[model samples]
Target: MPVIVAASALLFSSASLAHQLKSSVTTVLFNKRTHNIELMHRFYLHDTEHAIEHIVGKQADMLNSKSDQLQFADYVAQHVAIKTPESESIKLKNVGFEVDGKFFWVYQEAPMPAEPLSGLQMSHGALQELWPTQVNMVNIEGQGKVRTVYFDQQNQWHTVTF
Candidate 1:
């Protein structure tokens, strides 16, 4: 009985020190009128700041430092890429990013192809470098279809058709 109690205490203490799960969600949507695909990426501020510090330096701070925030956004722009059905990469305009409460959002828009999509390819590789257990969730919504994909060490791009 004493041994069981001691083992349970050790298990609980070990679990308490384990790192929490890390995740982010990216949403892609197409606007018919504007002929552009809009992207919104949401990430928890705590994890994001931690990631920035991990990649750049320990002193880096996203919420307090303007350069840190821009650097983080630039990191997002570099990792994400969009390709049309014709296999041509679309130009992405990183409009801006914002920190609202506990989360941050990065906005981007890419001009849609002149021809209708036979298929779309989006490569979103965020946070995987910072943490091996990071999971990047991407959801594409537009037309009549909505699709979701998860990115880990083995996953990168999310490709689907309407």
Candidate 2:
């Protein structure tokens, strides 16, 4: 009876703690120079979107200004820590513009080839989709010029630039 209750309590506590340890936000940093996107998961144990929304909403209300939209951008950089896809630690030096309402991030280091000769590639077209706004040009470091195709909200692909 007592032992059973104690065991249940312990299990519940551990489960709660484990949930708290996992990251809530998956941050993808784009390096135009290296032509690689570094995906990171922030392990602050809370949902990143919720936090941003809450902070930004509060700030907007307080300021009563439309310009407060940029507050969320500032909050992310101040509170969020960069983590790798595997939940490893990473250091982000700068986080730049928020394109199409999503923040664009930059890292201190250029990406190195994980495998010896295999070329770097992204599994998905995340780079293009990361920023919802139209991109005019994409210049990758070391890799020279890269091509990009832009589509509108209607999914119509019209523009292509190198």
Listed in order, each prediction's TM-score against the native is 0.84, 0.28
For each predicted model, how many residue pairs clash, with residues at least 3 apart or on different chains?
Answer: 0, 1
Pairs that collide, model 1: none
Off by over 4 Å in 2: 19-37, 42-46, 58-162
Alpha carbon deviation, residue 33, candidate 1 (Å)? 3.3
lDDT of 2 by residue, 1-162 (tens): 999999999999998876544222333435555655444422221232334445555423212323342453444344333333344444444434323223323223335335322122211122123234312222222333443322223333222211
In Å, residue 157's CA in model 1 sits off its true spot by: 2.3
For candidate 2, the 10 contiguous residues with the lowest summed lDDT are 118-127
> Please, what is the whole-model Cα lDDT of each candidate in the order they appear?
0.83, 0.36
lDDT of 2: 0.36
